[model samples]
Target chain A: MISIDWYLALSAILFCIGIVGVLIRKNAIVIFMCVELMLNAVNLSLVSFSSHYGNVDGQILVFFSLAIAAAEAVVGLAIIIAIFRNNFSVDITQINLLRW
Target chain B: MITYSFIFLAVLAVATALGLVISKNTVNSALFLVLNMVSLSGVYLLLQAQFLAIIQILVYAGAIMVLFLFVIMLLNIDEEESLFNKFRIKYFVAFLLGVGIFAQLIYSIGSFSDTLPVVSAQMAEAGTVEAIGDVLYTKYSLPFHIIAMLLTAAVNGALLVAQHKTKPLTEEND
Candidate 1:
């Protein structure tokens, strides 16, 4: 009963929340979670479009994206941990060694 | 029928997202993210992409998040306090960017009604796993390989980043 439009709207709102998380949170771990949220939002839209058209390719693509997300989370979390250890804090503001 | 459930899931998803943003406890945030992912899996099911829904649950809700929990627990994150400030401008700019993207998507969807029917007719198959495998193997082989390579890259990159160097730079013992 949920129209494709409704699905799209839900995804849009979720995507916006993810964007806000990425923007407002300074913790790298939180930021990474937001990135995952964004990916999930896109996945929702992809499945909706695939179903709307009856195409399976879009659904398949979600698998690939999920794999990439896993890799990203693993890599990102590691870097954050390493950064935390090096700096003794995950406060993001204190770990500004790379910034110009 | 499903619209009611859709609204329900939407509420759950938003609530968890708020938790993810505001929760001071890292483990709590991770748990909220799991809740969010589970609701997203429900969204996929509603879309009729059964395969994708399962993957969303298994990979995202199950595996990746457990990994997050492990790190949070192993590191024992809570005893330390997180510092609070200096990025107000960054947050405002990112909010504006999100609004811009949403506006453009709404505009495009509104303006392009004519192409909808054709797109729908083409996608009418409600993509099955077999159908996807066939198309990806036949029509989109190169992109598939590229995606594969990217996954490999991300995995390798992550593993490399995670490695901790125990050896000291001074090497006095050696």
Candidate 2:
């Protein structure tokens, strides 16, 4: 039988992988993708817990998270596009204007 | 069928994540990210969070990633052949962060060996759909409304930002 522990473990592993991607990837857009990955990982964990506890709280929380993620993605894409248009590049290294 | 589906999705998710890392082109990375999101949605289904799984596909794979693809299309990104240049320090920092997180996870798993057996039966008498609506209305109603407000503000902010095209100040000086 498949176990919730196993599901939780998988979610944890995915979360770590996403964290690595966010920390390591040099492209700003890739970093944004990694952020999405991390959010999904958290969503996995939330679903697992909600199911395990027999409550709908997890699902509702997931709904809120999805909304927040959508908003974040829209805003992030807009900012990145603005940056890309001016610099003619997508690599995070080149957009170091914030490094005062 | 369940086991096979889980294995396939798990493999696909990891592979696509690797694809995201190895591919040099922005468009390719975005595509891989979409693949990863799709696989993740499958995982969500296995967990019985059907609503969440659908939202995952619609929001992440459908809506947000498409926006990303369009931005990639609109930008000056050419097919990058080589990305490993003089940016060694950034690579090192990312590597360290990954490794550190991995180590912490391993240690936590090791310490959790005495965990109680995972309860197989979900306790709530009501189904997942019903329970979720109840909690959202009762315990989490305040936060739910607040999140809606936050999302509205974000949409307005994005629209405002997109419309403001700040031309070069030098051009304005003439």
Candidate 3:
């Protein structure tokens, strides 16, 4: 039987990669993809724990997370598209009008 | 067999994730993210979340990714260059932080073992659609309805925000 620690480790590594990508990547969309990666990592952990405990709560929670993720994607992409229309670029470094 | 499958899926997930982050072209990155999502769904299957596995593929790989692709193509943004130029201090800091976080997590969780009671066979059935539906509709019905409302609002909000320039304000002023 695969251990829970294995899953946990994998999730942790994936989450850190997402964080790194968020920090290093310049494209707004790629940053957004990294955020999705972080969410997926959390979902993996949640499922692993749910299975470990033999409870349905974790899976149900996953359902809610997935729903929220989808909603977030729509709003986020709309914002990105809006920004692209005005700025003509999705590079975070370039779209710094709000930077103080 | 499960361990082997886990290793395979995990490697695929991590590889595609890295590719998504590093690929220069946005379209290529998007495709890599799709591969990552599919591999994650496979991992979900290994975890016995049959329903979730299917939903992951449908919602994430299908709907969400299509939305990403549409915006990506619609924007027609070009590839960014010199992403790894002169070693900025921030990049170093970010890498350090990532490594620190990973080390901390691994150190903390290394000794931990599963203590939860093994799921009873019947309770394990809860991973199925029918079982989840029973709980979702009964105990979590209010939140479910709320999520439905939220989705509708998101759709309307996206439409409003993304609508093309409706005859510039200057035309109205004239």
By descending lDDT, how would the candidates be arranged? 3, 1, 2
| Candidate 3 lDDT over residue span B1-174, tens digit each | 888999999999899889888888889889988998899899888777889999999999999999999888888864667553244886998899999999998888777775653333544587889989999999999999999999999998888787777634554553
TM-score of every prediction relative to native: 0.84, 0.85, 0.92
Determine the iRMS, in angstroms, of model 3: 2.0
Clashing pairs in 1: A53-B123, A53-B124, A54-B123, A54-B124, A54-B125, A54-B126, A54-B127, A55-B127, A56-B127
Which candidate ranks first by DockQ, i.e. highest? 3
Docking class of 3: medium
Please, what are the lDDT tens digits per residue for candidate 2 over residues A1-100? 4666566666667677777677666678878887887787778778777766666767777788888898898788777776776786777767777875
Q: If ranked by DockQ, best first, what sequence of candidates would result?
A: 3, 1, 2
Which of 1 and 3 is ahead in lDDT?
3
Q: In order, what lDDT does every prediction score?
A: 0.76, 0.75, 0.86
Name the regions of candidate 1 deviating beyond 4 angstroms. B79-84, B110-125, B140-153, B166-174
Candidate 2 lDDT over B76-113, as tens digits, reads 47477565445677678767877787678656655644
Q: Decide which is better by lDDT, 1 or 2.
A: 1
**Candidate 3 lDDT, A1-100, residue by residue in tens:** 6778888898898899899889888889989999999999999888887877778899899999999999999999988988888888888877667866
